[model samples]
Target: MLDLVAVLLALGLLMYLAYRGVTLLILAPAMALLAALLTGGLPILGAYTQIFMTNTGAFIVSFFPLFMLGAIFGKLMDDTGSAKSLAGSVSAWLGPERAIVSVVLCCAVLTYGGVSAFVVAFAIIPVAAALFRAADIPKRLMPGALALGAFTFTMSALPGSPAIQNAIPMPFLGTTAFAAPGLGIITGLVMLLLGLAWLNRRAARARAAGEGYGAHADGVPGPDVAMREHAQGEGFDIAELSGDPAPGKPHRDGNLPPVALAVLPVVVVIVTNFAFIRIVIPMLDTAWLAEPLFGATTIESVRGVWAVIVALFFAILLLIAGNWRRLADLRASLDKGADASVLPIFNTASLVGFGAVIAALPVFDLISETVLGVGGGNPLMSVAVSVSVLSAMTGSASGGMSIALDSLGPTFVDLAHATGVSLDAMHRVTAVASGALDALPHNGAVITLLTVCKITHREAYGDIFIVACAIPMLALAVLIVLTNLLGSF
Candidate 1:
């Protein structure tokens, strides 16, 4: 039908425009209006103002705290030299021979502790650059190293990860961050090991080709050269690189905070988050949450969100307390973090609005029905494929996951129940799938990583595609097979 054609066209337009570097702020609403107008009976302005804004506003309301707090926490880490100090210690401990693993672990630790991926890239890149240069690793491999750590296991498959990808599925599937604990642990390890192997292999081949960290084609010094220049007070500054001048200059080991002190805040986040989810929130008598004003919510619906928020709050205070004397301007850092959150939240919310409008069209009903019917009654594969395709289309994990679950979550839940599937399995699978295709060339995270590392897609995207996308997809398939055979865990 023409309605279906219009829906397809809108999706195609969204992907194309986004890939061409158009901001989603414009493309989401424009593509949404196109879909609405082509459907032939809706008031275009009403759809934009009413349906679109409502869904967008709802997403922002639900997640603003996490976004804002996480950004602020990451900014504090960057500003205080905590992030760089941790990176430096890890690099020294791992030695130049194990540079790839060192970089990957640094990124994994930060992200698993709830730092935003965008912020992780910015915070870690200079360190990654320095390590790769020291190890004589190809500069092009930096993105892969960073992506492997930040974009893989810790971001999606790890149980108790504070990543938004993991959090988004909690309310929808009525599951917790620790959903499918056995499966998540297994998948996380698989991704970590396999992705590391791939990157190491690539590094070996690049070494065989005698390719060292090449000079930046744009005249920026390679990491080693830059560090040498800094030694002579003529190089790119760390303060400038991180956009915070608190850590005025690189310090000798004696001048830096102790490694344990540098790492304590991250540990606090993970530990506090776990305690809240496993103990604190459950013990509280929150019967009042069932009131109408609270939408008659259950503990399962809000436990994960509450845990992460409290954990972030605790971590923020800890980070500040640990680095108070080193801070440049506390107010400026807070303002910068708060300001930084606006674009990402709005970008995703815009897509949510676009999806809301698309869902209002009659054609979306047909589309949802078709997607829900995939895999011949296996809701696992059905949800996987549906979520993957939509994520690829939206070029955003959070955005695509929000749209798919908002429109089809109930249907997927019903299908899982009918098929005797565990909601935990569904939640885990949906969360992992969202991260898979969502790493396509156009993905916001991928773009940001590439931009931060200053590498072209031609040089770095292949490795990212393999480690972040292809490998995650493979892990998803393996998870599906294992769950189907062993029954949900």
Candidate 2:
């Protein structure tokens, strides 16, 4: 009982502190030790070194390549003006009347193409701001628009998205990113359509209220606004326009590239990713993958991750090749990307480490039994509930999913096999489940999106919660029911 209290307390503290902006790198170990001391009869330092660091290191080793490449690809897209060109073209084609849909679609395209969600937020905000202002939509709706696009479908439910949320479940389930394609498409569309309808209704309400891009002191400054303020009417400087180039640097081409050239790299990532998973990997003789050095892993175990890596690598090369002249410093962009991946990977790894220590405790057995039993003989319900709760508690979709899977994944796998459920079903359901409750107000991604758009939670978080959290939860429920009825595809 005392052990349970300590563990619960530690979890609460971790969440509260994370919400308060404490670094998880420091918070995770401290909380783990606290829980360890309360449990008693354990080597505290050894737990930190052996359990925590080992798990953290293992996560980094497994995922570092994807993180690095994804970041580089996103950065290259941003620096080369491809992201803006994509956003601008989409916004233009959709026109101001369809501003909400346009912003969401642009974000979806960028994220589905492997751009970091963080990068997508920064890349699309200026465009989103301008479009909203032009359409007479409330500025407060910007975060929800961005969240609906970046956080919901593309981040989790999309078939070939390179987001870590989609990739994290692959090895555990021995499934590809294309897992449960039918279910993924169905759920993705559900969230997309429902979220759009909600946002449009909100827009209609605002219009009825006679509200039009209500002024905010910290609202994102659009390039058009900047151009209007400048006495010379010189148009936006490169940095001001795309928000990529650093000041005091020699300016490259400020003009948006041809739409085809701008969008091709993204297309490359998606197409190459699908091809690698469906065609190339199947043709390879992967018998050596069963060796101890490879952890006796099979092609399915690594195919999903490998597909994304190759896709991102090729896309990065294409981005560089096409935008070589426009990039002010290719090396700087790569270095920035490499540097960008460190915090997110480490943050998630810290949570994984924390989970490892917690799992080692005797008390964890009780918690696990309760969580595992919640499904009452249904693996889908068990996975969905456990992952959703952990994700909400952690305020990170990836971190929460990693922790839950690391601790309970094997048990879930056994449950699935015994119940005759497909691993692909398990994989897709878990991935989608993580995205649901993980959009709680304290979620790092949500907070970052709000901060980037310079909107207060009061003005925007309600809409975000509805679209990203509530709608996704509904989609998860439907998915669970569909899987139970139709069985996995």
Point to the candidate with the largest lDDT.
Answer: 2
Question: Over the stretch 131-222, how does candidate 1's per-residue lDDT look in tens digits?
Answer: 88888899898899898898888888888887888888888888877889799888888888999999899889989988888886421222
User: Which pairs of residues collide in candidate 2?
Assistant: none
Full-model lDDT for every candidate:
0.81, 0.85
Worst 10 residues of 1 by lDDT: 226-235
Query: Which regions of candidate 2 are displaced past 4 Å?
Result: 217-245, 248-253
The reply for model 1, stretches above 4 Å from the true place, is: 217-255
Model 1: how far is 324 from its true place, Å?
0.9
What's the distance in Å from true for residue 428, model 2? 0.6
Candidate 2 per-residue lDDT over residues 1-489, each given as its tens digit: 888999999989998888777778999889988899899735898999999999999999989899888878887887888988899899999898899999999999999998877778767887898889889899988899999999999888878888899999998898878889899999999999999999999999999999998775543444332122221111123354334545523223556677798899999998999999888988999999999998888887889899999999999999889878778778877887777778778888999999889888889999898897889989999999989998898888888899889999999999999999999999889999999999887777776677668777898999999999999999999999999999877
Please give the RMSD to the true structure for each candidate, in Å: 4.9, 5.1
